[model samples]
Target: MCAKQDDAGAPHHHGPGTERDTDGSDRFEVDQEVQHALDRLTLLINAAEALSSTLEVDQGLRRLCRTLVPGLADWCAVDLLDDHGRLRRIVVEHRDADVTAPGLDEGLLPPTEGSAASVARALLGVGPVLLTDFPPPKDEDDPLCLREKQLFERLEADTAVVAPLRARRQVLGVLTLARTRREVRLTEDTLSLVEDLAHRVALAVDNARLHAEAQHTAERLQRSLLPELPTDGPLEVAARYQPASTTARVGGDWYDAFVLPDGAMALIIGDIAGHDLRAAVMMSQTRNMLRGIACDRKEPPGKILARLDAAHHILYPHQTLTCIYALVERLSADEPWLLHYAVAGHPAPLLVTHDGETRFLTGGRSLMLGVEPEVHRPAATDMLPPNSTVLLYTDGLVERREEDLDRGLARLRQHAAALAREPLTTFCDEILEGMAGGGSDDVALITVRTAPPHAGPAVATP
Candidate 1:
């Protein structure tokens, strides 16, 4: 049977060949060839559309399979090279509805050494490989040859083409297209078209892979920089750090909770000026400096931040930072938690009572860090009653462009009051979802609820 054109103007070939004319005269060979080219072009356009359909590497590769199989080829497979240059069959698919072998579910294939498969040769970066006929199964007991024989038999492939998937002039993977009972005559023009399609697919796959790797590395570094909150005392601490969602830029927001040299605990949240790798690096530096100064000086939060303000000029000049450094101290579990904190152009910490009353702790506000080292930042004190929650956060939590800062603060207090009785993790999550969801800036928050004597030990959430 022949094919017909769909509403989208793309030819849909059921088995191959063309439908006879009404007069029963054969169509010109050149016209048939032109129709085939147009059909292949439409398929290529659809394949390009699927390139950025997903950011995941595996899903992006599989999208190529779904786009090509049953339309341009009866079978399609993608083989990618690992970091160690080993061939991994990432995707394998056929037009048969029931056939499932040689699919993505199976693991890595054997190494490509001494293999007759065109996929292996294409990976060598020489050029495309076109096989008009399937080679006879080898007599030797080589595992790859036996595997190739099995694949050929199962897919009933009569012809195949393997093209290199390259990025930055380096081979990253191989694309294989196979034909079964309805043979595809891959002339020079058709081979060139397939190679062009493979070109676009390779770039998309490479870009996705690189992006995933970079995001993973950044996450690892960010996690390493954020130390665990203390969970062994009267204080229950929960902290969260979310990168900006608007763009690929990594922000500088960070939170830290650590024990001072004294018995007191220190909580710090800060944001450097920029939103890139440099800002992230500076954020780590500033956080460490504040921690070290607090531990070594054994002073109140204000003096430690003052020291950081001075040292910031020497360590990383021409940069600005906003931070809130607070120290939690108590003689015993029976007493209420005493919070001594200092802020440098940062949002005031919120104090939520156990009974759902909420208010911002608007004391000790000062100029942003590195503005002027000579200006001494003062400290303020607040007595957080047992079962009260104190929230330290960066401005990203309550600074939206659509409204005034005061309005954002009011909204935050409203939601926080409603969620005051929830667990620390749930409390932080709900507040973030309610207030900071889809905000352009990065967010860093630390919520600590003073546990009463009856309650068990404090817990920390990631």
Candidate 2:
């Protein structure tokens, strides 16, 4: 063997019979190992991204499982310890769609003992467990082992790895990966990689659970802050609050219907400008303030909203919102109802007849509340015949990012007209079902129908 150096003092190692680095099997093996390492690093990066993609627990877990199946294993399963300390299988994802595992559906499994193997041991914080050439449990074996055996046989698993999903020095759950082919077996050497992936999974699951809990709490508080519709009244009323499609943010939409001291029925719908706990808290305060002012004064809807605007400006500066205020009243019980309403930077109130005719109340329009405290707002009145209905709603019901505002308005009109002749309860429900897909924002709507006892659209859903 011989080596020659060029003028640059570097060995060329070219030409026949000259010893070269490329011909050695050791060098080839080293190159293969480097490529394999690079590939594994890429896979791990993808898994992390998939896990953190969504704040939905099951969906995010499914993504992570998908990243593992057929890439690292034939299938994967995730078992989590619930709030009650019970072990529940939340995901069992298999690569082959044709393979059916009878007992592998996500559900509760029997208690895991401290001495159990693999998944159970991992749950007990025993670190990663690798199983090779495993055997199926007998019929009378430990319940947890029996379940695992059933899964193993169904998928024909020859090698498996179970690792604890750990975060903050605590084991939150367990991740299991099973390989059906013996040649592509998982060994103790790969336990480090599997355990590393499990840690990322644990963090994502923890974050998603926290987000869901916060969303539930905020929505519950918002619901509690809302006013209950009057059960005893001549007007049949129904109000609904639909949260946004994603619970990532708290909504500021609200609806209120209450009777004033002077016997006028007050109807209100409003939407504050933010999407956080602050907006929700402000909604409660604003609703209470408006209720008090409406009760204290005998003014029409416009005057009442003007007073509310002034108060909102003084208390919560730089905040803006849209609102509609209306008072339904008449001189006596026998007379027809008169709807005295005012609008402040809100959608027009809809009027639908018993015969399925619909129209938007474009009168009494003014800038939305919180804009001009001293601005003179106007009010409009419309006489409602027996069995007629009036609707007030937030922008969420008729607003889509990609479509024109007029198109959404038209969709609302079409749905409202078709549902007009239906019972009040039916009308409310069907309208929501029909129009909810129009936008992704939070929605709040109030419907008031005038009717005689046992005759008109005042039908209620108990």
Candidate 3:
């Protein structure tokens, strides 16, 4: 038998200043309606506040399921449509959340055909459906509906309200609120409040989903822009990039290596100022501009960076960048590798000798790009041991908020010296694993080690 839900009881109408009709029912009815309206408004406000607490769609939905229990309904479940339009039950909660949670996690898909949980119809803009009674016993129920009926029977709920969760006129999911133990059935007024609540919840969920999708797209673009290091060369190159774990969007740290016209290999590592889509775009443009200048000009690292600095106003105005540009060349087979590089507002690269000695290549220092374009930039050259490794990295490699930059550099030097005897690829990875864990910044590292005389080509293992 269907039970009719009643509003909250009004206070006694025979108080001293209270006015009443002859039958004395008018004031009582008006007070009861006012109380019901206040309760509905409170429920709506609480639901909105709970759902707005998180930007993670699944977490928001879970909170939404839990928020509307016992006070608003005995059970609440949300079914969201996946990309391919399949209905998936993402959250299910009850008045007694712990016990009913396992049973609620059936992960069943709602029906597409003729069934009460017609998610497809709901997506097509159906407002809400209120069911007063379950179908006849012989009618088979989909797994989701069957679970709902089982919960309803267990909780002794005789009424159910299903509404579309919509945002900006687009239906994103379905919201189900069922009442049990209370004889108060969902009336028209209550259904209207349910629809409003569903609308607010949908807005939060949609915002979170859009953010996740944008991050995914940005990361894919980031991966595509990063180049693979060469496996066989006079200097074996290994690289690693680890984005900040705290943010969803990709950062602007990048590394590039290409063979120059003079048979010398050029390596560049840079980081732009921000960590969003605009920063990523600027990073790509700056990298490409540097590549063009580096290749076409056939100049030393210092000159190329100077020219890039001069062009910064036209290319990326008011932007800041830190970069290390270096050219690796060996004149003859008998001599050691000659390393010539220039730096602009970047952390000094590290040189770890085969004998386990480590020092930062601190000689090449200049104002960062875009700081003073016409300023004369200086270049530095070092005679690297045949088996020595040079690491060109972004500032994230040796920067921490808690310590001084000099201290972080000293720590990195010590670690590099300890791992100097390992293979080149392993050496690079070990340094990254050690340093990249604690920071909330992007890290880009390029490690190049001159091959020992007649040594086989070094493999790119990163």
Q: What's every prediction's RMSD, in angstroms?
A: 10.0, 4.4, 7.0
Candidate 3 residue 167 C-alpha distance from true site, Å? 2.9
Residue 83 CA error for candidate 2 (Å)?
Answer: 3.0
| lDDT tens readout by residue for model 2, 165-214 | 88888788899999998788998878988988888899988888788888
Which tens-of-lDDT digit does each residue in 234-284 have in candidate 3? Answer: 678888887776575577899998878777888889999988878878888
The 0-to-1 C-alpha lDDT of every candidate, in the order given, reads 0.81, 0.84, 0.80
Report the Cα lDDT for residue 293, model 2: 91
lDDT of 1 by residue, 289-326 (tens): 88778878788788888899999978777788999999
Better of 1 and 3 by lDDT: 1
User: What shift in Å separates residue 163 of candidate 3 from its native position after superposition?
Assistant: 1.4
Tell me the spans in candidate 1 whose CA falls farther than 4 Å from its real position: 1-55, 62-75, 83-117, 120-127, 133-158, 166-171, 179-184, 228-232, 242-250, 292-307, 310-318, 331-333, 352-367, 370-380, 395-442, 454-462
**C-alpha root-mean-square deviation, candidate 1:** 10.0
lDDT of 1 at 9: 86
The numbered model that scores best in lDDT is: 2
Total backbone clashes of candidate 2, pairs 3 or more residues apart or in separate chains? 2
| Candidate 3: clashing residue pairs, number | 2
Task: Give the best candidate by TM-score.
Answer: 2
lDDT of 2 at 286: 94
